[model samples]
Target: MDAATLLARLATVIDAHDWAGLPDLLHRDFTCRLVHTGEVFDRDGWVRLNADYPGFQRMHVEGLVADGDHGALRARVIGTSETGAELEFAVASFATVRDGLLAELVEVWADVGQDAPAGTRPQLT
Candidate 1:
């Protein structure tokens, strides 16, 4: 799969909350780094976290760019917590593809502040 196709599939998985289908797009030794928390996670760790969190109500990709073997995407995620409070976050994701699958992912995200809308600018900071 090319970078665009892989990223598009990733968006679909997150939108549908289909954790079971994630492995199909990942390498066996895939690794992800959470920029904010400085946490490094393996493939299994990614699956577990996604399973624990309630799925997002909506995710809008604001920008996407793909190079030969690299891709970058910025999106806005909107969801409601268990307490029914609305939440919004801007997420910037970078990926390196190898052998047609995602081998590494680095994600940087932040909660949208009061001044921002649910889907605003890309959060690269």
Candidate 2:
């Protein structure tokens, strides 16, 4: 599959929570980096992390773009915490593909509802 198709399929597979399908879409040397947490994971580790994530409800792809072997995606993830709090997160992912499979992925994630920094800007009326 081309980069765009591969990325689209990836979004679909993730949203469907098809952990078993992740391996098929990833290269043998696949690696994932979590920018916010400063963590790195190989294919097996990444798959296990996602599969065992706490309160993973679903993910929605907000935007996606690809150029040749590189792709980027913006996604909204929803879940309920162990404390019964509803949670939402915004995630940005950059990916590189090799031989039609995802080879490297770097992701940054943040809570969706955080306010701007105290002195960054005045609130609009």
Candidate 3:
């Protein structure tokens, strides 16, 4: 698959919570680096981490740009706690594709703030 197609499928799989299909879009040696935690995880480990994410409601990939074997994604994520309070996050990741699958992903993320009435979508500026 091309960069765009692979990324689009990734977005779809994430939003749909298709955990089983996620590995199909990634290389067997896939590694994800989380800048916030200064840590990296292998494919299976990464999937497990996301599965345990607290109060995750949705992940919206707002924009993706790719060329050759590299891609960048701008995304927003929203979650609701038991108290019914909503939280928003701004996420950015740079990815490297190899053999038509994601080989590496480096991500930066931040808890932007609570969501307003309009929505929890990240404000891109």
Each prediction's RMSD over C-alphas, in Å, is: 5.9, 1.1, 6.0
Off by over 4 Å in 2: 123-125
**lDDT tens digits, residue span 27-83, model 1:** 888999999999988988987776676846877888889997799988899988889
lDDT of candidate 3 over 19-59, digit per residue (tens): 88888898999999999999999999988887778888888
Query: Candidate 3: misplaced stretches above 4 Å?
Result: 114-125
Model 1: lDDT equals 0.86
List of clashing residue pairs for candidate 3: none
Error of 1 at 83 (Å): 2.1
| Sort by lDDT, top down from the best | 2, 3, 1
Q: Model 1, poorest ten-residue lDDT window?
A: 47-56
Model 2 lDDT tens row, 1-125:
76788888988888899999989999999999999889999999999998899999889999999999999999999999999999999999999999989999999999998988898997689
Structure candidate 2, residue pairs in collision? none
Q: TM-scores of the models, in the given order? A: 0.85, 0.95, 0.85
Separately for all candidates shown, the number of backbone clashes (residues 3 or more apart, or on different chains) is: 0, 0, 0
Q: Which candidate is the best by lDDT?
A: 2
